[model samples]
Target: DQQVKQNSPSLSVQEGRISILNCDYTNSMFDYFLWYKKYPAEGPTFLISISSIKDKNEDGRFTVFLNKSAKHLSLHIVPSQPGDSAVYFCAASARSGSYQLTFGKGTKLSVIP
Candidate 1:
């Protein structure tokens, strides 16, 4: 089975600092990678994504990087904020037409002021 793994279960960062979240996947066939952020008692919201063809994709403070050779990817949040504290999940899909995400366990980030 294709699996996404997050080595760190949680991370702590002071406000205005950078937060780096790591993830690795086992399947080379997977072409799409995504990150989702979820708050307590709420559904997850899409954070960012990157295609296998591209090494990096960025939107404002959120950036997703893909290393197809290593089957590894990471998300970087610059100047992390307290509101950024949430559970982050890394997901991947081989299907391009319809996305069925195979998600990592999740990494909870606590951004402290």
Candidate 2:
């Protein structure tokens, strides 16, 4: 069973357009959510995060919205640029333990010039 899922393997958008990525989870115990952006052959960098207690979190061009009832979350990038063409991974962790995060396969967003 995939505890976390990103249904779309890739997405393409024009520069200065909005890019939206979707994610879903099956575990109800997850209390912390995170979004990570990665370049080729590099580790993911933390983009934004939201706790289960909150529904929305935003940072700069990135925003994450969580729907606890549906066990779903999404990431939105405003005015996407060519630099934004990278893999985005959605991760979640429970409150217990060392806060180890589980990740989705990732969605590769390609921004056209």
TM-score of each prediction: 0.94, 0.96
Which tens-of-lDDT digit does each residue in 31-84 have in candidate 1? Answer: 999999999999999989898989999999998888888999999999899999
Cα RMSD (angstroms) for every candidate in the order listed: 1.5, 0.9
Per-residue lDDT tens digits for candidate 2, residues 1-113, read 89999999999999999999999999998999999999998888989999999999989999999999999999999989999999999999988889889999999999999
RMSD of 1: 1.5
Question: lDDT per model, in order?
Answer: 0.93, 0.95
What is the lDDT, from 0 to 100, of the residue 47 in candidate 2? Answer: 93
The total number of steric clashes, by the backbone 3 Å criterion, in model 1 comes to 0
Q: In candidate 2, how many Å is residue 31 off? A: 0.6
